[model samples]
Target: MSMTEAQTTTRKQALGSPLDRADGRLKIQGLATYAIEKSLENMAYAVVVQSTIPHGRIRSMNIERARQSPGILAVYNHHSGLIIHPAKTFGQGGAAAQAFLPLQDDKVLWNGQHIALVVAETLEQATEAAALIETEYEQQAAIVHPDNPDARPETVDALTIEWGDAVPALAQAEVQIGGVYTTPREYNSPIEPHGCIAHWQDGSLTLWEPSQWVGGARQVVSEWMAIDREKVRVISPYVGGGFGCKGGIQPHSALACVAARELKRPVKLALTRPQTFTAFGGRPRTHQQLALGASRDGTLQSIVHDSWNETALNDVHKEPCNAVTPLMYASPNFLSHHKLIHLNTVNPSWMRAPGENPSAFALEVAMDELAWALKMDPLALRLKNYAEQDPQAKIPWSSRQLREAYQQGADAFGWSKRPLEPRSLREGRQLIGWGMASGTYPVRRTPGEAQIVLYADGRLEVQSSGVDIGTGTYTILAQTAADVLLVAPESITVLLGDTLLPRAPVAGGSQLANLLTGAVHKTALALRDMLITLAVSTEKSPLWQQSPAALALADGFLWLSDKPNLRVSFSELLRLSGNDKLIAHQDTFATTASEDDRNKADSTSSMMVPPTEGGVSAHSWSAIFVEVAVDEDFGTVRVKRMVGAFDSGRIYNPKLTESQWIGGMVMGIGQALLEEGAIDDRDGRITNANLADYLVAVNADIPELTTIDVGKPDYLATVLGGKAVGELGIVGVAAAISNAVWHATGKRIRDLPITQDKLL
Candidate 1:
C-alpha cells in the first residue's frame, strides 16, 4: 500500500512531515545502550598489536614478558592460541572487505595488520600489555605506492564501460579539454570508533557490535567458527556513526569472538583513532586522466575517464571510479576504464558515497574546464547538454526533477548576478567567486523483514534487526506504522538492532528508510487482512453481512467502507474473536533491474508489497552552488555561502533529509579545502592519523547554507515515492567547491584538498 493512500486520523501527519526521533530522549538521557557499554560477568578487555613493517614475514614473537605483566590474562600471536578457519562470505554483496583474517598466519601484507591479541583484566592493562609485546620481522623490499616502479595494471571488468571510440573522436572535436585529477586517501573516522563485545553461552556465540550488516556478520561468523547459523547471534541496538566503515565485519570482531570462547568469558575490543585509520580501512587514493571533447556550442561529443586506485596484494576491491562517468551528460561517444595497482598498503574499504563521490569530483570539475574552453557559462553549458534519458541504459527515469533543481538552485544562489571572468569579484583583500555542479546516485533498494504485533490494549509493536547509524531510522519506522494503523506515533513501540528481531538489510546505501519501512508496510497489510476476516466472522461485528473488500480500517477501528459512523474498536473486535492480539511478519525482496518491465510485481518498489509501477530507472538527482572567498595575500579560501536543491522522490521527513544534505555539503567543503589522509613514503606508515592534524569543517567554518526540495512524488520509484537520499548530497560537492576556487583565482588545481600552497 502506498503511503499516499494510507488512511489517517486526527494525527494525520506522516511520510513527509517532520516528526521528532523516537530514540532522541533515550540517547540524550544516556539511557540508550551501545555495544561497548554493555556489562557482563567476568568480562575481559583485548587490545591488538599491529604489524609495523609494510611487507614481510614474522620471524618470531615473544609474548612471555607481556603475559607476566600486571592484570594480564592471555596473549596470542601467530604462534599462540588465536586460531580460526578461513571465512567464506565472498562473491556478490559479501560482507568482508579484507580477506586476510587476523592472526591466521605469520605473513604480513601491509603495515598495521593485526600481529597479536593481548587480553587482560581491564582495558588499561590490555593496552599496556599490547605495547610491551615484542615482534620481529624479516622485512622485504616493498612497493608502497601504486605509482612505484614495480606497480602493474590490473584491469577491473566491472568498472570498464565502452560505447563508441573516445580517443579518435576527441582528436576530431572542435573544443577539447582534459587533465589528470587526483584525490588523496581519506578515513571514515566515525566519532565513536568501531568496537564489539563477544560472549559464548551454552554453545551459542553472541556478539554486540556496531556493524551495519548484522545478518552478514552472523553468516560470516558462523562459517568462521564452523557453527550452525542459528547458534551465532549479532546484536547492535545503537551505533554512534557509520559512513561505510561499519558496513561490513572487521578483523577485530572475529578475533574478539575467538578469544572470548577460548577464555570462556566475555571479551571486549575497540579500535583507537589511529588504529581505525590503518586497521579498520579508509578510502583509497585515486588518479584519473579525463578528456572531454565538446562542440563550439558546448555540446559534449566525446568523454573519457581512465583511472587507477590503490589495492593491496592479497585483497582485490575496485572503486568503480567510472560509476558516474557514462550517462550524466549527453555524450555520444564515451570510454570509462578502472585499473588496479597492487601495493604494500592495507586493504581499503568503502567510505560514504564510495564510487560516486570520487567520480563526481573528477567529472564535474572537468565539465567546468570544458565550459571554459568553449567560452560559456558553466551552468549554461550544463543546461545545453541535459540528458533527457539514461544515455547508456536507454531507459526513461522513474521520476526526475534535475532541471528544476538546477534552475531553483541557481536562482537561490544568485547565479544571475555572477561574472564569468576569474578574479573579478573582490571584497577587502578577499577575492570572491561562485560555481555549481550536478549530482546523481542510483537508488539501491535491498531486501529486509519486519514483525508487527497489535496488542489487546490498543498499542502496537514493530521489530527489526536494522540499525540507525544516526540517520533517524527509529523515528521514520514509527511514523510509518502510525500512518498504516492510524494510531498516534507515540502509541507505537519500535524495536531494532537485535538479531532476534526479524532480519533486515544493512543500514548503508541510504536504503534503510525505504526497505525497512516497506517491511513494516507489508506486515501491516497482512495484519489488517487478518483483523478484517475476524471482524466479519464475529457475527456481532458492525455490518457483519458486509464484504471484506467493503470493510475499511481507520484509527484503530473497523467499519463499512461507506459508513463512517458504523464502527467497532479494534479491542472490541479482538474480544469478540477471542484473541488477545494479532501478529504479522513479512520479508521484502527486490527483483532484478529489468524485471519491473516484464512484470509489475518485479518492481517491488516498496517495503510493504510488490510494486504496481514499471519500466524506469530509479535515481535521485542533486545540484549545488558554492561561493568562496579567497584571501589574496595568504591564499586562504573560505566558503561564504552554499545552496543545494535535491529531487529524491518523496520526502520522508523534511528536517531529517535537509539535515542530511547540509551535512554532506559541509563534508564537501572539507574535501575541497581541508581533508587528506597522508601516508608516509619512507615506511608506508599513515601520518597525521589524529584529528588535530586532519581538518574537518567545523560550525565556525560555515556561513549560509540554503536548501530547496523538489517535492514532486515518484510512485514508480517506491510506494512512498522516495528514492535514496543519504549519499546524493555529497556526490558533486567537492567539484563545485573547487570550481568556485578556480573562478576566484584563475588557478585550477586538479588535485584534491585544494590547499594554500596550490592556490598561491
Candidate 2:
C-alpha cells in the first residue's frame, strides 16, 4: 500500500453539493430553540449551592437565613422532601458520571460539589438565596498534582495487552527514545451551557434537555426517579454543541426534576459558565510515558506506553491513552497499560478525540525523535512504516489511502524544499520549519431507524431521533433522502431530536452521518418499492403488473425502465390507489464482526451495538502539515500556515465538511500552544476557572488554514461508503505543531500547550 506511481494518480470524486445547510435559516434568524429557551407556563427557577472546601466533611448547614430572602420558595438539602438515591462509584456504568449525586449524603469529596438546591419563584431570587445559604465543613488534606509519579488508585476497569518481551526487544534495537508527555485538564466549553427543564404531572415526567443521546437520557432519568422508563419523554430540538459532554443526564437534571416533584410545578435549571466547569464534565489531566525502540532504517521494533490519569475521589474515569500505540505502526513487540489516580477534583468525561488526541501527541512526537535519531525524513519514515492492515483487529482496512494522503499533503506542503536540520531554514530573524504527521480515527457504526412519509403534494418528510448540534445533520440527511428517492433536496423535510420518534444512535463519534444516511436511504428505497407496486396494480392508464426492479423513479414520477417517455407523477398514482399519502419505516443496523460468521448471534439486545464483523476494519485517515516560526529572542512560537489532507470516504456535503475540518484544526492549535487547566496546589482549587483566565484559540491567534479531501469511497464500511470525520481532523494536529516547533528551534517539547516557559 505504498504511494506507488499508479496509485499517486488516482483521484476520488465528491458526492454531493455545497449548498446552504438545511437548518441554516432557522439558526441564523435566532428562531432555533435551545434547551434553556424552553419555558413552561408555570415554570420556576432552581439554583445549586456548592461546597467551599476542596476535601471535607459537612458539619452543619444553616438555611434559615436563605429561606427569609426575597422571592424564596424552598431549599432542599440532605434532609429534604424528595430522596435521590446515590449509585455506586467508579464502576462500569458509574464511570461516565463525574459527580455521584446531589446531596445524596453529607460527605463532601471535592470542592464545588453540589450541596443543596434552592428553588424560587424567579431566577434572580434562586441565585441570591443560593449564595446566602452557608455550610460549615471540616477541611482535610487534598492532592491535586497531575504529575504525581507515585500516585495509584484502586483499579476499576483496566486493560492490558502484551505481545512479546518488550525489554529484550528494546535492548536489541539500534536506536531508542524515552520521554514523558503531559496534557492539561480542559473543558469542552460548548457555546450553550448545560441545562434542563423538568415538569412532572400525574407521575409522568416531561424533560426538555440539551443532550447528545435522548434515549440514554430517558433511561437515566427513569431509573434515577424510580419510575417507569415509558413514563418519561425527552425532547432536545437543538443542541449548541456537546463534544461528548451531553451524553447522559447529569445531577442538575435530577435536581430540577426533584424540585418540580416537591413543588408540584415545572422547574428550570441552567449551570452558569463558571459553574459549568465544575458541574459538567471535562477532559482529565493525563501523564503518559512512551518508550520507543526502532531500527536504524526507521522500522519500529517495540513500544511500551504507561499512563496515569486523574479522576474524582468518588468516581473513576480512564481514557484509553494507549489505544492507537500498539497498532498505529508495524510494531511486533508492544505493551500498553493505563491506571487511574483519584484526586479531589471534578470528574473528567469525554472531550473531543478523548483517547486518541493526547495519545497521538505522545506517539507522533516520539516518532519525530526516532526520525532524528535515524537521520531520516519524518514524512518518508512514516511512509516507510505504514501498516498495510489494522494490526489490532488483524484485518485489512476497509479503505485506506493514507499513502496517497502522505504524497498529496507532501506535494502541497513543498516537502522537497524542506531542510533536514533544525534552525537551518531561517528567514530573517524568524526560524522557519515544516513538519507533518498522519491522523487516524476508527469508523464506528450502530443501529439507526428512520421513517419516510411521501405526501400528496410531492413533499417528503424524514423522521429520526438524532440531534444536529450545528453539524449540518439536517442538510446531509435530506440530501441522502433526495439522492435515493430521486427528488429535489428542497422537497424533503427532516424531523429529529425527539425521543418519541424512531430510535437513532447518538450523534457523537462521527457515526451519525454514516449510520443515519444509510437508514434514510433504505427507507426511501422501501417507499419507492411500495409506490411501484401501487402504480402497476392500478387500472389507470399505465403499465400493469410491472416488477418493482423494472420501474425507475425520477423527478417525482414513476416510469418503466425501458421507456424514457412513459411516466406518471406519484400524485396521480396515489390518487388512483385511493390514498393521499404513503409511509414507510426502515431500521438498519451496522453489520458487526459476528455478522460475517453464519453461526454466530449478537450478544447484546441494545439498540447501539458495536461492529464485530469480520471485514476490513473501517477508519478515516489524514495527513497534517504545519509551518511554524520561532522567535528565539522572546521564546514565542507562531503557527504561520497549516494544511490538512483527509480521507473520510464519501463527501456528502463539501462546504460543511470543510468547515468542520477547519474548526478542528483551530482547536488543535489551541491545544498545542494555549489551553491548560491550572490547579492551585495549596488547597486543590482550579486557579483559572473562567474564560478570561484560561486561554483558548481566538480569531487573532489562528493562522491561515486549508483543508483538502483525499476523497476515497469506502464501500466496505457502509452503504454510503463514508467513515466518521468529526474527530480525525484534529488527531495528529498537536503532534505536527510540536514537530514543527522542534524543527524551528532545536528544543524537543514533550509536554502539551507548549508554553513559552518551556522554550526559555
RMSD after CA superposition, every candidate: 4.0, 5.4
Which regions of candidate 2 fall more than 4 Å away from where they truly are? 1-15, 86-99, 146-150, 153-158, 540-550, 560-566, 590-612
Q: How accurate is candidate 2 locally (lDDT)?
A: 0.79
Deviating ranges (above 4 Å) for candidate 1 = 1-11, 89-93, 539-552, 559-566, 590-615
**Can you give the lDDT of residue 209 in candidate 1?**
90
- Clashes (backbone N, CA, C under 3 Å), per candidate, total 4, 5
lDDT of 2 by residue, 19-60 (tens): 678788988899998877986898899998887777878899
TM-score of every candidate relative to the true structure: 0.94, 0.93
Name the lDDT of candidate 1.
0.82
User: Which pairs of residues have clashing backbones in candidate 1?
Assistant: 518-607, 518-608, 522-608, 650-721
Residue 390 lDDT in model 1? Answer: 76
lDDT of 1 by residue, 523-615 (tens): 877888888888888887775767889887766778887776787888888777778988898766554434332111111222322121256
Best by lDDT: 1
**Candidate No. with top TM-score:** 1
